[model samples]
Target: MAFKFFDKLSQDFAELLNDKKEYNVVIEVDKEENMKSFTTHSVVLRYRLPYFDKELENATTNENHIKTIIKPNISAQIFEIILKYIYGGIVNIEDTDTKTIYELMVNADELELKELSVKLENYLIQSKASWLKTHFSFVYHSIFDSDKFKDLKKFYNDIIVKYPNLIFESEDFTSLQETALISILERDDLNVEEIKIWDYVIKWGIAQNPTLPADSKEWTKGNFKALKITLQQCLPLIRYFHIPGEVIWKKMKPYKKIFEEQLWDDMTQYFISPNEPITSLILPARIISNPELPSRVNEPFSTIIKNEHVAELSSWIDRKSTTYSLSNIPYEFKLILRGSRDGFHPKTFWNMCNGHVGTIVVAKVAGNDEIVGGYNPLSWDNSTSTSTRMCAKDSFIFSLKNGNIKNSILSRVKENDNALRYFDSNEQNVYGPLFGNCEFMMRSNVSDFTQDKQCQCKYMESPIFQIFYNYEKPIRKTIELFSIVDYEVFKVI
Candidate 1:
């Protein structure tokens, strides 16, 4: 057998990537403020990627015989990774963040780098499965925009079929792509009721045409035609004969103008005489099953803290002298956001937790089991342009006892006017929940708290050397900055 020396060959080409002497292609990436250019050889790109092959054919060369390709959408970081892979036939994501890796996969697919895209897609599904679920909504909507990533589509579709509400009840359900909607409807195992599916389809169709009257009863024939045309692809996927006759009359009658005369007559006749044959085709009823709830739904409320911690936190919220027993906690801890599930970005915090009142923000310190958190009695506002301090007499900051820490500490607000600090909209991208004058705060310049160690629990003293504590005591024994393993924001209902 012949020997293989791909490692050496790869190393040689990788070194070539750094050589600026003979490059003939320049690629400009990212928007204006962050735009960056890279020099490359066209021969490497022409043979390595089909997308570049076509792009290079159409691209005109300058007098220096160097061709330029402008890609404002792709980030410079992602392109750098792609460029290395193109020349070296190697990819190293060991140090890259999961979000960056995901973006690289998307960009690779766009550039027709099927091998790279498929490899990254499989890696994400196998290694970063937790991250994929945490950013489920974004991932689901993004994959449907194109026909690539079949395995990812199947992976998410399996979850959607079991928990139909994840997609159907989402806030942006109406904005779902037509292909995605049809894929769900085409599923024989979709567990939702037929009537509800019909309603959602009608809702989706109506949302596409804003000019249509609010009331279907006030609709003109033209409006009906407009809606029918919008829903033409979706209409056929609905199981008409499967829905109850009463529901048909109640829901389907108003939109009768959309159906052909023969189909409508056939449906009506089928309902009147069950034994009669009809010209319209009848699709099989969906295979509905009351499957056991997925582990995600049945999992404990918070992955970072247990029920004992919840009881303790609840007792503190109501200012109870004694910790409430597990069975008799007064308030329910309703989780609105989880750093591991939603995202670790500070902006994700403002987007999801905005306007939420009576909230508790808990975070597990990295490299240890210690949990520190703050309570905010007022709503979190992301609309403000200037920094604003919320006033709450009952708000407090605390560190819960864990394996690494023996005793829990509670620090009620000593300064009522500075109980909580809400950052301006521009600063929200870097700063999350804040309490007092940097007494206990979550701040990340990199936009991801887990990726940075900027979050702190310090006790600051005034310039005059007098104690400038905003709260009664420090939550952590040592005043130091730390990263987090995970964080959760719950509404104390």
Candidate 2:
């Protein structure tokens, strides 16, 4: 019986040996504090080897078959996190670990790994770290639309309140500055009026970090390209103050050509089209307020005083057309005016009144004016009750003459000897800090530029003035035919 039991026990022990197996898995790591190294295939393998293989480092005879490799450039923390990702494909969002994720995102950006960067950014946004908040703001601003970052508005508001000067304050923002500035402006609650002041601040910043001509080729080209993109982000807000990036950019001649080329591209498109005639020619207008309380002497002054001529014309155009279609006006026609910064608006007004010989009212009686079109400012007010009014009580009839025809245009541009050649005839308020360069002609050039002769010049490809002159012939003929019917009626006006 004892021999039979021994035989059964021996068979059971052999069965137990058959069920056990060994794993020879390889796991490479940066540090050995949390891992063990082993040898395999006559090569030194530094990894988290199995316990049986952990004793492989004890075999010095195997050193001859071993390779000693340097540790990876990764940090221990990163290595462990990477290992975690390798094992479970997941990472924690805690503050200590979140920084590692951010660095990963930054590395992803450097590597141009779009999916990785996006995923990391999403994780950082959820982490809610204050600095991460700023970073994610930049990432979201660049990658997505303004509304996508709306949830971060309170964060931006807090930053702005704490540092009101932060809008212009730039550090090494990498590739995201443009999107960040534009996104900030797009927030409806933010104050747009502060844009000019912020622009000046940003200008100062760029000037301080001025792109010098002697700079290395890469910086001059690449850095300046980035700077230009940032400035363009400020374009929409700058329009409100008529302060283009060019105003500050001209001083930095290192990137002058680049900036000019960009500004030309942006503004030129708006100017080239015939639809936005006034906007094309006229710079943005300023608003002036009467700070002093009205006294008995000055009580009639406007509460909000401004040059309303442009606004008046814009309103009229808005009213007359459901879709910018000026009645009887050619689709390709535009009315242009030439003026200076000091008195541009008023000068533009005067240009409307007496500057053009072919289009002004004086052409009917004296053959000395040019009439582009006439407007009753109030008739153009889009807010009018009827919405289609064509006349206003306080109205002015102004016109445009041929600018390409030199002699006729010269007559209307009266020069003043008192001021080294100034257009002293037109009386309108003006202010200056002239941004763009414009050429001026002495008064004698006005009539020459306004003549009705067919343009033989190759540059005047459109023949704009010829079109204007012919279009108004019916109106002029009506006046002339009316005078013959009743000669006494001509004296009324």
Candidate 3:
């Protein structure tokens, strides 16, 4: 009932605003050499519009006690819309073009109709995002030209940050004001190389001079001086030390006169002797460009393991460490198999673990609930011809305890040492004769450099060391020795 009453009252007020009458105040609108005038109720003008209220409050009374307000800049079309909104409590901007709406935004801003101005800005952003990107030059010039449209300024600034290359490489980059260019240069995470940034700066500076030669070979000292003058404010913003030494000595040598004597000498001396302190006390923060999160789009590997050991093993391979996330990892892990779920025999497991490169193995110890995994970058083969497929230096094993990751075992790929190589296992030729330079060994009575036999999965080839349930070191036996908690297999693509 209360809502209905307010609704009726609103309609009546709107009807009252629409009613035309002989009003007391005259608002003259001049546009395109045409003079137009609107008569408005003085009461409504003072009550509805703050701009008019301030104008009338400070205005001196005429002989006939009439107020005449002149707006020479506003067009008749825009004023008509504003007048309707001022009188009828409705802003009907439908079917209006972007330019007219832009004009209305300006007019609304001038009239202090903040709500209507916000509405127009939102409409432009939603409806004309593409057009705005295309005509960034016109849009940037118009918005920054006036201090009224703050929302518009922010909208453009955000889009510029997301796709900075669009503006940085555009022809209008040279026309960008110093403040605008500084805005782009200030962000440390602006995804661009230092060399590309230097090139753009030089281009923008060169564009500032009309008399400058197009070919850099024909550049004169006067042209360089002119460019330096144009880029004097911009040069300080660039991290000159971060650029390559070759580029500094070769590309920037021509512009040496531009830099202050002290700064140039400091830069040159710093390159010569990096250990010595430089003039600038600060260094640029390096860009944090870690890989983005992986997409589960192309048939992801997900498991609901019943045992805690298998659960944690599955968690680590999919880049879900309790302490670390996989956002920094560049590979997408796809489910290849699970040892307990697949019910693979020892011979089947060996055959399956042979030739698949980039495989990760997560084994959970039943006694201590310690999770261990190995990353194999090279595939394993059964050939005893001293082949390159024997044991890889890139293969590494890791341990996860209490959700923290630690590197447990790594292959000793050292020069003048053939210790961590695969040869015929004294026990069996199919899966034995595993000798490696593995760290944190249980026991290696085989030799000083060569360790005990390591297990190899024949199909998915990687050196594997067995983990005992109640003990760290297992006796020289196959998978038939102890009770296993669980194990998971993953392929990193």
Instruction: Please identify model 3 stretches exceeding 4 Å from their true place.
Output: 2-21, 30-35, 58-65, 135-157, 211-213, 216-220, 249-251, 265-273, 280-282, 285-493
Q: Highest lDDT among the candidates is held by which one?
A: 1
Model 3 C-alpha lDDT per residue in residues 1-493, reported as the tens digit of each score: 3345755655665665545565567778876478788767778887778788777766556787767888888888898888777766677654566678877887898789988888888877755453455456656776666776787788777655545555664436677777677767777876667767878888878777877877877887777778888988888877878777788998887778777888788878878887898777445953745333333222234331223333343344333435222212223454565656664333333355556555665555444444544555455344444423243444444454433323232222322132233433331232221323332121123321112233321121123523211122322222321223555556654
Q: Better model by TM-score, 2 or 3?
A: 3
Q: Compose the digit string of candidate 2's lDDT tens values, residues 1-493.
A: 3345655654553343223232132334355564433212322123321322433455334233433322334455654443343233444433354456666665444434455456766644433332433244354444454443343455455444333233333222333455455655554434334435444535543653555344424464666665666566454444432434444444333444435464445454443552543432333433323233212113222121112322233333333332221211111111223222112232343334332211111111123232222322111111223212121222223232323322211111111111111133321222111100101111111222122221111111244633322111211212121000000000000
Inter-residue clash pairs, candidate 1: none
Candidates in order, TM-scores: namely: 0.53, 0.27, 0.50
Relative to the unseen true structure, what is the C-alpha lDDT of residue 168 in candidate 3, on a scale of 0 to 100?
A: 68
In model 3, what is the error at residue 393, expressed in angstroms? 65
Order of quality (TM-score): 1, 3, 2
**Model 1 residue 12 lDDT?**
96
Model 2 CA deviation exceeding 4 Å by range: 1-76, 85-98, 104-127, 136-190, 194-237, 241-493
Q: What TM-score does model 1 achieve against the real structure?
A: 0.53
Error at 308, model 1, angstroms: 16
How far is 286's C-alpha from truth in model 1 (Å)? 0.9
